[model samples]
Target chain A: MEEVLRRQIEKIVTLTDEEFRFVLTHFTARTVKKHQYVVQAGDPAPNDHFVVKGLLKSFYTDDLGKTHILQFAMEDWWISDPQAYHNKVNATLHIDCLEDTQLFFISIDNREKLCVELQKMEYFFMKKTTAGYIALQRRILSLMSQKAEERFNQFIQLYPTLLQRVPKALIASYLGISRETLSRMSAH
Target chain B: MEEVLRRQIEKIVTLTDEEFRFVLTHFTARTVKKHQYVVQAGDPAPNDHFVVKGLLKSFYTDDLGKTHILQFAMEDWWISDPQAYHNKVNATLHIDCLEDTQLFFISIDNREKLCVELQKMEYFFMKKTTAGYIALQRRILSLMSQKAEERFNQFIQLYPTLLQRVPKALIASYLGISRETLSRMSAH
Candidate 1:
């Protein structure tokens, strides 16, 4: 588990062995069953879960009761509602395990304390957030510019492995398209 | 100017007088004329500009010639095209000065070099980028959930001083509304 996470962190910032060990001690491992909700909308977000194994998705239900998937986290990814997690407010989204999952949970309090000790860890998070923001901005622009089929093709291209793992219906919802539309498009 | 910047830096991470001076040497002060483009679409972005005075905007023009205003920066704010600035790629967005402006420019290369000297400076930037990402996520959610009037009102509430300084057309574009609609709403 430390090996996988260490590799992920190395991509963002290099840490000394001592610093990595200090950072690792704070995270608590938690196992979640498939389809289990780790967090739900309106509940307080306790931690930013780092995926060690399996898959998770964070989503929100709109006024019409339509589930809009905001993010999908596979191995080595971090999943949380950033605003809710930072502020410790009632979450406006839900995170659920799509497969039986192993995760490292780091709470906001722990994150703040960790940043105090290991400043380089902050760099790891900042790089992740910046990368996420850039991707989101491009995703929004694509949603505005591209057709549904084109968006789906792009999504498949970007996360080909995850595409086979997640259901098409959920993927369609995430893409802001009807499941029927997704089926029709996939058939072509 | 240094005093104000010091306070801003302290909001993220504390810097000693000597450390702050070290950072100051790396930044070049620039003055932008009104209506001048600081970073244009298709040009590689050179630096992240920190506003000392005046206003600037970053926007994207789509194939249909509709401009999507992504962000507006005022005094004490940092502005850049994230993808272009971070990846050193040709920008898909343009940044223009709304008024005659004074700014401190820091190249990405210089910033990385400085981080080796002052790790705390890196922590400062990390927090700033995280805050920016969180704010941008909220803005995107507002675009998804709120009506034009609500977004306009929220924009006004957040940047009352900027509302007075920037033109109606840019504000309309920022709110994703027609200029006529913004005029009507403002009149009412």
Candidate 2:
């Protein structure tokens, strides 16, 4: 589990064993079963989870009871209600395990302290956040410009692994297409 | 113009006069007229612009010649082809001035150097990127769940200044609604 996080950090910045150990102290580990909720709407989202194993998804349920998948986090990915966590507000999104999951979770306070104590971690986080910002911009463009078939093709190209793991109906929800439309596209 | 950049940075982290001057040295200023292109598709997007005056928009033109507005940058906002800028790839978006504009622009290399030299800047950027990520998530949820009228109302409430300045047709395109639909809703 620690290896997963160390590898992720090493991808951007090199850290000595002592530095890596210090970083690890700021996080806590957790194991959750499938169907367990890590974050739920109306509760404070105090920690950001870094996935070590298995799958989890964050989503919002609309007034009509329609669920829209915001994101899916697998190994080496991070997931959280970023707004709630950063702003210290009640979560507007729910995050639950799709498979029995192992994660390292860090509260905002600890994360900030780590960044302050280790300048490298601040650079590491900035790079991650910038990459995430770029990805969300790309997703917005895809949502605005792509037709359902095009979006499905793009999704498959981007996350072929996810296609195998996630339910097709949930994938349809993430793409904002009807399940019928997804089925038609998948058939083609 | 330098004061604008300094003020923005100071909002997140206070800086002494010497430090602010050091930060300013990394950026260059430019003036662009209405309809002028700051970034164009297929060109390398090497710089991110910070708006000092006037408005600009970034958009993608689809294969079918339909244009989709990805973002709008007014005074004090930042605009760039984030993917292209960060990944060192050719731009997939075009950014053009909606009105005569003044901007302070920084290349990715200079920006990185600044962050490395000043830890506070790195923190400022991480906060800004996280805020951008959260805003994009909110937009995705709104797009998935809201009706045209609800989106329009949300847009008005969030960016009343933009509604007064931007063309209604462009606003309709941004909201993924037809111009006719926007007209009908605005009338009511």
Candidate 3:
């Protein structure tokens, strides 16, 4: 688990063993069963989770009770409600495990303290957030212009592992396509 | 123009007069006439711009020749082909002036150097990127679930200034609605 996190951080910035140990002090670990809710709508979502193992999703349930998948976090990925964690507001999204999960998490306060204490971590986080911003821009463009077939194909191309690990219905929601349409597209 | 950027930075991090001057050294200022393209699709978009005056837009033109507005930057806002500017790739979107515009910009290299030399700038950028990520998530939710009228109303409520400054056709494009539909809604 330590190696999982250390490797993730090392991809962006090299850290001395002492520095890595210092960084670990700011995070706490947890294990959750399948179908567990990490964050619920209208409640405080205080930490950002980095998955060591298992799959989780963050979704919005609309007034009509229909759900839309905003994102997914698999092994080595991070998940959080941005408004809740960063702005200290209640969550507008629910995050839940699709499988039994083990994860590490850090609160906004700890993250800020860590960034201030380690300039390298600040740089690491800046890069990660910038990359996240770019990805969301791509998603917005795809949602605006792509057909259902194109969206599903792009999803498969970009995340073949996610395609298998994630349910077809959830994948359809993430792609913003009807389950029937997704089924039709996948049939080919 | 220097004061514009100074004030923007100060919103996130404090800087003394001398420190602000040091920060200004990394940016270049430019003035562009209306209809000029700052970033064209398929070209290198090397800088992230901070608008001091006038209006600009980042848009994607589809293969079928339909254009969709991704975002707009008026006074005090930033605009870029996010992927190209952050990832050092060619632009996938076109960014152009909607009016005569003046702005300050920093290249990715200069941004990195500035961040390293001044930790405050790194914090400023990290906060900005995180906020950008959150805003994009809201947009995704709006697109996925909202009807055209709700999307338009939300835009109007969130950016009253933008509604008046932007052309109806472009605003329609940004909202992912047809011009005629927007017209009927606006009429009411």
Specify the highest-lDDT model's number.
3
Q: Which RMSD values do the candidates have, in order?
A: 2.5, 0.9, 0.7
Q: How many backbone clashes does candidate 1 have?
A: 0
Tens digits of lDDT, candidate 1, B100-185: 99999899889878876887887778768777777876666665556789888999898899778889998987777788989989
Interface RMSD of 1: 2.2
TM-score of the A chain in candidate 3: the value is 0.99
Worst 10 residues of 2 chain B by lDDT: B119-128
List model 2 lDDT by residue over B71-97, tens digit each.
Answer: 899998999999999999999999999
Indicate the DockQ of the complex predicted as candidate 3.
0.93
- Stretches > 4 Å off in candidate 3: none
| Chain A only TM-scores, each candidate in turn | 0.96, 0.98, 0.99
- Going through the candidates in order, their DockQ values are 0.43, 0.86, 0.93
Error of 1 at A95 (Å): 1.5
Kept native contacts, as fractions per model, are 0.31, 0.85, 0.94
lDDT of 3 by residue, B23-115 (tens): 999999999999999999999999999999999999999999999999999998999999999889999999999999999999999999999
Error of 2 at B155 (Å): 0.2
Q: Candidate 2, overall lDDT?
A: 0.94
